[model samples]
Target: MSNTVKIQRPKIPQDIKPLDFCPNEENLFELCIIRDCSIINEDIHRIRFEQVIFKNVIFKDVSFKNIELTDVIFDHCDLSNTDFRNGSIHRVEFIDSKILGLNLSDASLGNVFFQSCNANLISFGYSKLKQVLFDSCSLRNADYYESTFTKVAFKECDINEASFERTPLKGIDLRSCTFDRINVSINDLAGCEVTSNQAIGFARLLGLIIK
Candidate 1:
C-alpha cells in the first residue's frame, strides 16, 4: 500500500544526437534524441527540453505553450491533440505514449512516470502533480479539475469518466484502480482508498439505499 514515488531515471548521455524539432533554431534542448518526427498544427512556444529522448514522436495538433521539460523520455510517442499548456514537467517518462487530448492546463509536474499510456481526454486543469506514477494507464475521460496531488499513484488505471472535481483525494489509492463511474465528491472521499466494490459503489453515490 505504498506508492513511494521515485522516478528520476533519464540522465541520458549515450551520445544521443538526432534532435530535430526546429521551429526556427534552438530552444535550449540538451543531450537530445527526437526521432521519427511529425509536428502538425504547430504553435511551439517557449520550448526547452533537457536530457531529451523522444522516440517515434508525432505530436499532432501541437500547441506546447510555455514548455520546459527536464530529463525527458517519451518512447513510442504520439501525443494526440497536444497542447501541454503552461507546462514545466520534470523527470518525465511517458512510455508507449499516445496521450490523447493531452493538455495539462497550467501544468507543473514533477518526477512523472506514465507507462503504457493512452491517457484519454487527458486534461489536468490547474495541474500540479508531484512524484506522479501511473502504470498501465488508460485514464478514460481524465480531467482533474483544480488538480493538486502530491505523491500520486494509480496502477492499472482506467478511471472511467474520471473527473476529480476540486480534486482532493488525500493519499489516494484506488485499490489497484479500475473505475466504473467517477466524479469525486463527498469531501473528495477523504483519504480515498477504495475497494470492496468501491465501497458499495460509493454507497450508491450517496443515495444510500443499499440493504
Candidate 2:
C-alpha cells in the first residue's frame, strides 16, 4: 500500500477566474477559484482544490492523478475521458454533470454527493467509497469490480450494463434504478436487495425462466 500522500500547497487566494485555455503538461492548481472554465488536455497532478467551484466547466481529457479535492463543488460540468486515478476526494459534490469514460479506479471518496449526473462507463474498480450518493444519474457500463461501496446509494439512477462482478457489497441499496444489462452471475445477485421492476429486467435479460 503506497501511503505517500500529496499535500496541497497554499497559494494566493482570489475570486473565481474564467480560464479559456489550460496547461498541456502536468501542473499544480492550488486554491484557485476557477469557475465557468474549460480546461482541455491538462494533466492536473498532485494538486489540492479547496473552496473552489467549477460551475458549468468542461474538462476534456483531464487527468486528476494523485490529487485531493476538498470542499469543492463541480456543478453542471462536463468531464469526458477524465482520469481521477489514485486521488482522494472529500466533501465534494458533483451536480448535474456529464461524466463519460471517467476513470475513478483505486481512488478514495468520502462525503461525496453526485446528483443528476450522466456518468457513463465510469471505472470504480478497486476503489474505496464511503457516504456517497448517486441521485438520478445514468451510469451505463460503470465498473465496480473489487470496490468497496460503504453506505453508497444509487437513488433513481439508470445503471444499465453496470458491472459489479467480484465486488463486496453487503449493505448497499439501489432505489428506483434500472439494471437491464448488468453483467453478473445468478449467484452474485443473491443476498442483494432490489425492487420488483429491477428483478424483472434482470431476469428478462438473463433469459431466466421466472414463473
Candidate 3:
C-alpha cells in the first residue's frame, strides 16, 4: 500500500432525506442512514445522541462538544474538522471512519473502539481515555499531549508525527506499531523500539542531543 493517504467521502444513503432540525428521537432513525452528508459552518452544540447508530455519516466543521453519547456507533464516517471536544462517549465504536482534523481535546472516552480508522491530526490533548482501543488506525500528527490513557492499545498503526509530549507512556509497546517522527518528551520510551530517524525524533521531543 502506498503511504499516501487519500481522502474519501462517507457514503450516504439515497433514500433518506436531509436533516433540517436538531436531532430528536423520531427522526434519528432516518438521520442515521444519511451518511457522507456535510454539516458545514453549522453549530451542533450539545446534541445528545443516545444509543444511536450513525453509520457512514460525515460531520464537517460541526461542534459536538459537551454532548453525551452512549452505545453509539459511527461507522465509516468522515469526522474531519468536527469537534468532539469535552464530550462524553461510552461504549462507542468508530469503525473505518476518517477522523482527520477532528478535535477531541479533553473529551472523555470510555469503552470506545476506533478500528481501522484514519485519525490523522486528531487531538486528544488532556483527554480521559479509558479502555479505548485504537486498533490499526493512522494517528499521524495526532496529539495526545498530557492525556490520560488507561488500558489503551495502538496495534498495527502508523503513528508518524504524533505528539505525546508529557503524556504517560508506561507499558505502551511500540513493537507492533510503526512510528515515523513521533514527539515524545516526558514519555517513557525505554521499552519502545524505533528506527534511526524515529530515534532522532524522540530525542528532538526531549530536546536532547544524541551523540
Candidate 4:
C-alpha cells in the first residue's frame, strides 16, 4: 500500500467548445471551457458543471449554492468573495486563482488541488475533504471549524491565524507551511507532522517553558 498522496486530475475532453456568454438558465454545463469571462451578481442554485475548464474568469457577487463541479480546472481565475456553500467538487484544480474570502462551507471536496492561489479568509466549516492538497496558497485567517479531512496536505502555504478549531490534524503534515499563530487545540494537533521550529512554537502556545 502506497502512502503517497496523489490527487486525481480533471478529465476534460480534447475537443471543447468555448462559452462566450454568461451562464443563465443552464442547470448543467458540460464539455465546455469558459475563458476570459466575468460572471457577476448571478444567483444560481444546484448548477452542475462536468468536464469544464474555467480560465481567467472573474466572478463577483456570484452565488453558486449547492453547486456540483466534476473534472473542472480553474486556472488564473478570480473567485474572490464567491459563495460556494454546500457544493460538491471532485477532481478539480484551482491554479493561480484569487479566492480571497471564498465561502466553501459545508462543501464536499475530493481529489481537489489548490496551487498558487490567494485563498485567505476562506471558509471550510463542516466541510469534508479527501485527497486535497493546498500548495503555495495564502490561507491566512482561513476557517476550518469542524471540518473533516482525510489524506489532505498543505505544502508551502501561508496559514497564519488560520482557525482549525475542532478539526483534527492526525496524519496531516505541516512541515513546509509557515504560520505565526493558528487556533488549534493540543488534542487536535496529535500525530500532526511539523518542523522543529513549529514544534517549539507549539510548545510555547501550550505554555511550556523550554530550556
- Residue-pair clashes per prediction, in order, are 0, 0, 0, 0
Best by lDDT: 4
Q: List candidate 2 segments past 4 Å from native.
A: 1-32, 200-208
Best by the TM-score measure: 4
What are the lDDT figures for the candidates, one per model? 0.86, 0.75, 0.72, 0.93
TM-score against native, each model? 0.34, 0.81, 0.76, 0.96
The better-scoring model by lDDT among 1 and 2 is 1
Residue pairs whose backbone atoms clash in candidate 3: none
> Between the candidate structures 1 and 4, which one is better when assessed by TM-score?
4
Better of 1 and 4 by lDDT: 4
Model 4, position 188: C-alpha lDDT score:
99
Model 2, span 12-62: residue lDDT tens: 346656543444343434445567767877776776676667778898878
The 10 consecutive residues of candidate 3 with the worst lDDT sum are 1-10
Per-residue lDDT over 142-176 for candidate 3, one digit per residue giving the tens place of the 0 to 100 score = 99988987767777899888888878777565656
TM-score-wise, the better of 1 and 2 is: 2
Candidate 4's C-alpha runs over 4 A off are 1-4, 24-26
Clashing pairs in 1: none
Q: List the residue pairs that clash in candidate 2.
A: none
